[model samples]
Target: MEINIPKGGITITKLLLRICSILIIIALVTSVDGSKGNSASPEESITILFTHDLHDNFLPFEVRRNQGKYTVGGYARLYSAIKEQREKDPDAVLVDAGDFAMGTLFQTIYASDSPGLRMMGQMGYDATTLGNHEFDFRARGLAASLRAAKDSGDAIPKIVATNTIFPTDDEGKIPANLQALKEAMDHYEVKDYLIVERKGIRIGILGLMGEEAASNAPMSGVTFDDAIESAKSTAATLKNDEDVDLVIALSHSGTSDEKSKSEDELIAQKVPDIDVIISGHSHTMLKEPILVGNTIIGSSGEYGEHLGVLNISLDVNKKWKVNEYKLIVIDDTLPLDPTTSETIEKYKQLIQEKYLRHFDMEFDEVLAYSPFDFTPFSEIGIELKEEPLGNLIGDSFIHTVRELEGNDYEPIAAAVMPYGNIRDSFGKGDITVSNVFNVNSLGIGPDEISGYPLLNIYLTGKELKTVAEVDASITPIMDEVQLYVAGLSYTLNTNRFIFNKVTDVRLQDFDGTKEEIDDHKLYRVVAGLYSAQMLPYVNEKSFGILSIVPKTKEGTPVTNFEDQIIYMNGNQEVKEWYAIANYLKSFDKIDGVPQIPVYYEQMKNRKVVEHNSNLFAVLKSPNRIIVTAYAILLAFVGIVVLIITLIVKRRRRKK
Candidate 1:
């Protein structure tokens, strides 16, 4: 073999050695990438558990999903889920981004019992923020609720309201109601921010309220500093002064599909030191954590439907590295905590005695039996079309008002309901008092009760048409403002100009008769007190282009809304929720239980939408608003053309 050695054998041997060297290098590189290699184990692991927009769902509530009623949330299930998470990491930091109150019958005693707060305390929430709904009963109610929570001597979570402001009077003193709120805050030891140690990691948490949240709480009497500014200040202090390992923002600011409106995301982008953001208020369910720079934004959705779990570990680089993030669904599959269930039952009893008894009702009294499910509460305002639940509520309003007024009843030309006010929907099967209250469970009446009282307001037919226009135009931009009506119907042209979307406006009777609306004739309109109060806000929202001033029957401009609240049965305030119960009871009964009629199962053409791209159709009925808009556009174009011509002539002269 040595005598017959092949030519270039030495060169081949060198090439083989080089190839083997490259393979060994590649294997070494692969091994380094696959395993920890020289890097040390994570210094420490941190677990963060969070929930947002709990919304007083202390019991497992049924929600309509995929044409089925699925049980979701409840403190018992939530507590069990929390306990499970704790078992995995006992030192997990638990917190909530607020709106924890004002959704169910539990909120009926929010001021007196503080059921939401006390329950959160029981559930072991380390910290929580205040959402707009916390002030739904106004500043006085919030103050009272805080005092009640403090008085309960329960393990209440630390409340961190970073931007809450108490405005002062000309005498440099806070108003009595706001002063009381301040005192309550001081008593509760509510701070702008709080710090805690979790398994040797110092965590700083700050609460913030968005501008829209502040605006929603107009009657709160307490204002808020700018959310971004507040977050920046708090985050800087926590990082630079407190020297915390992690900074979490419990923000009621919320996230939106629209970037400009996404408050929490904006905060994360602006505040670099904030490591995590628990966003609330818009009830957004962010299935996956949003990573912005080094910050992580998480949302667990509304009504305690899910619990957010975020896990991270400190790497050798001394920076926190995300390990995993998930939203644990609080469904029926989760075991219920017996103690929490018993506590919830006790709260139910308290609600029955303190609130439900006044209405001559039990907490679970069946108001009606629904053979079919109405629109799910989550889907109520998603689209601009007429909602069956809205029609039911609207018709219920008219019926209750008529029955209450009796012989003194004036013809109600329309009963309008804002989508924002329609909180929940009627699930199929037995509808209870709690269900009805949840549907109409928004505001407190002038009587300092839980429900918003019905009120009668007058509007010109022109304003009624404007209301239709608002529903057609503004609703596309603001779903919460979408108007649902009974005793009125109209066709909206999608192609029409802004503030001129309604192609036809008419009055429709429940008997299916359509009548022409006299532009100057005053029409009697019935709405919730909160809805009535929001009427004038249309002018402001529309930038004064569209106007809707709710007037008195005598054609005087109404000032105080409480004065217009409708009363019945010898001073018994007519609540919007009671109207639904009464209407359901009035329906034909089968086997002694009122049945929701099939008539409500279908839309009664309360709103007819027309999709047209025809230019002629769009311009057919140009209102004063459209004409003014056209004139402004023409002027702008003319000015631009004149400037261009001037510039061209000057350049030619220079040439």
Candidate 2:
């Protein structure tokens, strides 16, 4: 099928073919020279503006820290900071670790728009990991959030999770929840690792959720691989196969008080090939970068209080090094990105139109006044010991439950707050309803309310002692379960034998009266619904070393705690924030306005700590749990001694 072509046409075709060959050769050379098509050196320096554990703090908050008041955090301010950095160095990237969702009213629309991700997309986050809170609405909810983010037609970040071990054919039936999550992860191109070429620098990025974080996500059906192993494998792939110049691990594993237990630190030490680890979940603020072998790790504190800025440069040998590390404090002093501010306001309007309007709540209505600061982050706060903040919250629960449940509610003996549920602090100055909500931002029961509803239950005084015991024994493992009580005081001897840490438990009265708790008496107690459900699992978590049994004031056993849920405010859920707000409003007006009492300025001694764990000291007020714990310890020691003795005897006989 040969067709004769004209002489001029053939010459034109030959010239075109030669031009095409020359263009292909030039493209190959340009690619090989690492020329961002400019024949420049491949050595590139990058600046990273990183944040973690944002937890939906869309607006700057006026917070009192270290006896000073300042406004901190907000996407508007962060966007401006990121913008400045990017303008300075075009190679700069904005990234986050995880938990960018599920903290504020904006989280209510997670299943639809996922305004958090959308706003991040608008702010230009290059990539982000999934924190436990991202799955707070469950797998289906996460899927919807991702779908909405994609549908918005916005330039969204490349999401990644390196350690998610998806179910396989050999793993049996995949649960519907996990299947949905897997599909979303796939659709969003969430890979084990990503190689991004930014300004001639190939950066390898991987995301990980640590065991502690996985523990927090009880509803997330996905299983995660070991952080250390997964990180090492992914980093190796990036280095050996992809030849990336930098390996970055976005870890939601959190920093630990002990280096031995810290997940990110451990990864850094074990996987020295990783250049940087932007850690989250622990809410740790490291002023200086932690150097573990060749890797450097840093974490911005929880919320958007600070932006982590890191500069990385390559040495002559092409090995990466952190040139500078700074935790840039986000405050009102920083310029607000107008575009981002508008984006935030758009979500606020969405909150008003979609959810808050129905509840008759405005985002910034002043609810009360605080003359002093109250933060769980303090040394004596709920996260550690019982501070005045804990006392006020506990008392509020008692008062709110009594008012809403009426006389039939059997008078709550005390209200308890798990430290995990207390999110933000009450800063000195005008306390708005939003501020109150921030302090108590956590949980949604089956009713789908904005906050966890207050629940009342009855427990024997003996069970109260068990609760104290659990606090002492299990708190080191699960700090979130540390209980802050109102109307109760306990002296803890931390050095005492395991499961036998509390030395004294007494009932505290409003006038500072102290009386021994009657173990046989049944007393009503109040707690958030989520904490109430978790109360029964203490024994299981402790491997049956501890136990708790919730009951009714009538001495009847509680089979289904949910069935006994009492709705307040004419069938409205008595939200925790409302209880706190109502309680704050009840305070005496100081300076012609209701203010937090001056009493919180000083320690209330709710938890008197005596480190005397001597045998005599521990035996002072031993309850049944402590007595049993001692017996078990002694028996185990005796058995070990006997086994050794028998082995020695057998060895002597053989000899």
Candidate 3:
């Protein structure tokens, strides 16, 4: 120690001690920073299981009458799949894209009380967006559904549609009922967006309603803003202000494989920050998630047939990227989770019992049907070529209109039924009364046009040709123009220009005999309301050759054709139509008539041309108001009963 007492020994010792002190301080600072980083790391990862466009398919295994096989899909099965995925990851998020409240009779029944949403809540859905069909009953129906979801207890899904604005009265004041509805929405927990946190990751989910919803459904008091603008605003808020790590848009609009303007695509392009877009409305099945820059778009096919699963991973920095994505075809191969299945079954029974009590009938009676079969055709089938279902629907519509008019005006020709509008079909067999109701279940009210008696008019052959041409020329136009017709016969030369395809125009009366037609003459026609809008073409046409009578036989004005026809077809009836189509097509001959071409070439495009006897019968009959009213009233009663029962049950639960 004495040896260390060299020159400046104490000073050197002091310097060494100071250097050690600095090193210790640095070490302490580094350890504290490390601890902070560890603490700041995201707590846990989450997987989101999403489904959309489930059009009220609560049971699986649709029996294929002709093939004698079973198709898989049902709420019970879907519930099981969701539960299994959730259990696998306790933090899994479940969501629905939209179009969850219409399509099947089940939906019509549950629309008012939202049995579907209640069931979804029980199944643990985090959020849901409003589809166009959500407004099928207009504001009243949507309000009721929001109410049901709130009363169910589990946080009701955030009813997020940024673009939809509630309208004010003439005095520029919000109506009391509407204000109450808004308050109910607030009380019931239906929000525009929801920030869900799991394992320390904040996920922002917003909803979008399709533009088509505003036009197709009765959104009289609500206005829908531009999709892109709404999306950008919502995304900006979530990302900048909320500081959300991931943003998901549940869009009711759809993306097509073909070249088309999609709301989802536009939203992605305009609002680039969104991480994922779960879409529906068009009911398209994306083979894989579509990658549009940083956004991943996915949609599960409609009717509960598919479950969309997306797996994502977040980095230590809290940035997210899609790790895996797939649309799982929900079938029997996948094991069904017991807990979810039990819950689904419980709800199913409850719904069934409630419906029965409301309807004063048994569950089986509600589902009972005769072995009737008819072919159902889509809009494409009618527009591109002659479809049996189209012909039948057109005929039924014309006959109904004529009967309502007291048989004053005989419809010379009918137009092709607009493709997407015809929702059901007629089948062969006993054709029970229920089947009739099912065939016409969409409850569009009666119209009161100004000019003529309410004669629902269909475009003539030349008019159809013109409309078709317009439909083809306008790239972004909707399919609403292509009209379905009945009691008319004409040749379509797809090779010709618009209005030129229709040649050899003649009327095929009820007796199947041809009647003369004057190209300039206007005859009373019957068609859907969507078709009536195109009637304006009569005024705008180059020829100025046609005029719409706009009156029924009873001299009533035809204001709203779509509203006039109520109760299209029930789900079972629709299935029956397909079954009949398949069955008839299978036979080499029916009623000694050779099976018509199920597939035909028109304008170089292949089309399905099938026929059904039941449809033919409906078309042949004169439309009687009494008959139509009875059918509609019966269907309405059924739907009302089901809805009331669900509402009462929900109220009881809340109490």
Candidate 4:
């Protein structure tokens, strides 16, 4: 066959044969191994059911805009599904990726008592990782959850967080509770990866959380490590050391669209060892798992609204491979296990009866009326641009400060507020007392900076322009400054481009006096502490720091800096403080109505007669009642004294 071959032809032929032989040998070995691995395979199958970001939204189906009939994702349904899956395959393992706490009102209440984790443990969760919200209560709350889970005595899901670390004490010793918690977690929890052996296949599961969540979270004592680095290190250990059939990452990172960057996608790309990524945090529902090389990524929407199921098959060598995966919508049509349903109902009832009783009395009362329905977009209207809602909040802060510090002190200036901070609106109707709670749902404390009585200052018209322009240019670094002032009003000249769009600056007095602003004059202000620290306009200027005040009007110290108290008192209630603005608007009124083109425009032409006052009727109503009661008591005493005096004088004269 090589009769006319070149000088090196024989050598080349020999080399080719050797290569072929090696390839054939490798193939034969692989086939044999695969066959041997499958020879002992049983007829029964194993399944793994997983979920994440079940933010305690345990209610039934509710449709939202853009997202179609989302009738899935409650613990009851998830419980039923898991039970059914377990019935089908007794070796089923259920796991949550994280974020099982802190979203709805239910979570807030349950977190106070560590009921969510306890119930999850009772429901047979194999293991769980810490999400950002798990640390919402910071070290103390997290410790409590861990303790409660441990106390449950059921096969509690091994709580695992490889990146979270505690600070060392003076002697470099971790706190006793933290040490005990870590030990308990290491003993009862899986610190790195868990290997679940079903039938003949071995599956390894690892947990990861987003780094950004730690910074954004209200947690103070704990810190998160670099996610990518931690993942890479964990993967290396699991693959090289643990030697499992397949690797899965339960990631609390996020999903992405074309415009958004996803940490999960990045993790998959950068760390190739991860076979499947069940992700949460971004609350994206992937129609199907995205395949990147040998790995697959999937996510269910936030709240217990969707269930993600991954079906995998193993080859003869016990090597795990994804067969198919889907996100199942949990609804009534799907079969629910009675046992799981009963368990969920019991917990729900226990939670309602034991913990949430105060919600009715404290959070559900009507406080005032709104003339129009309010939504996020309402802020765009000329009349609604400066939200009456925000103005009402600002007014409440002023009043709370005044009551705390007494009547003599006047607020100088206020800091800017963020648009995102405005959560809900006071729609036109009977504004329930709960509306105030909903609007100011942030549980911020009473401190001056991080607390409610934040000293926020407004810039001069020229300075406002400068601040606004700066905010626009450096969007990333700029603080989200979108504050609405109570006594002050102004207009934005969108046509004329300047630093900020403010025009026609004027000073407004609480006593109904109006005066033109001198650009050089400085003013005092008050606002929430976080806004004051983060907003560039306030921090950049030399506005003197007024005395710090408590966030609450009831003389409560600012303990929870994250909670904000909103009041639903009407705009007319704040009008007294805005006397200057009202007076100025009087000159421009067409028919006893302010001629300001927009609500925000009116804010530009106004000034602060009183920077922060506790005049918000919603907050002051209780105080006023007490004051009236005291006055009545004093009057009765005075009348008795007059009668006693007459009687004593007459008796003495007769004697």
lDDT values for all models:
0.88, 0.79, 0.58, 0.55
Better-scoring candidate (TM-score), 2 or 3: 2
Score residue 515 of candidate 1 by CA lDDT.
97
Model 3, residue 593: distance off in Å is 21
User: 1 or 2, which is superior by TM-score?
Assistant: 1
What are the per-residue Cα lDDT tens digits for candidate 2 across 396-510? 8877777765656565667778877877677667877677777787876566646787777888888888788787878877777788888787878877766778878888876
- TM-scores for all candidates? 0.89, 0.84, 0.68, 0.62
Which segments of model 1 are wrong by more than 4 Å? 1-41, 169-172, 627-655
lDDT of 4 by residue, 1-655 (tens): 5454577456667778999999999987644332222322332344667788886555453433352333455667777767776786777667788888764444444434565677677678877787887765555556655666565664567666766666788999887656755664554554767777666555677888786566567444666777788888887777777665567788888777842467888888888877778887877878877877667887867666666677766556443456657676777767665665676566556545543342322223333434444443324222314454455455555655555445665555443455545534544445433334334333223311111234434444444433333333223233334445555545443332223223334444533365655544444545554554444434343132112223333434345533433222211121111221222223344434433223422333332112222344222322232456568888999999999999999999999
Best by lDDT: 1
The global Cα lDDT (0 to 1) of model 1 is 0.88
Give the C-alpha lDDT of model 2. 0.79
The local distance difference test score of model 3 is 0.58
* Runs off by more than 4 Å, candidate 3: 1-44, 61-70, 152-155, 169-172, 175-180, 218-220, 258-260, 315-318, 334-383, 395-416, 424-480, 518-549, 554-655
Residue 67, model 4: lDDT of 29
Could you tell me the lDDT of residue 183 within candidate 4?
A: 60
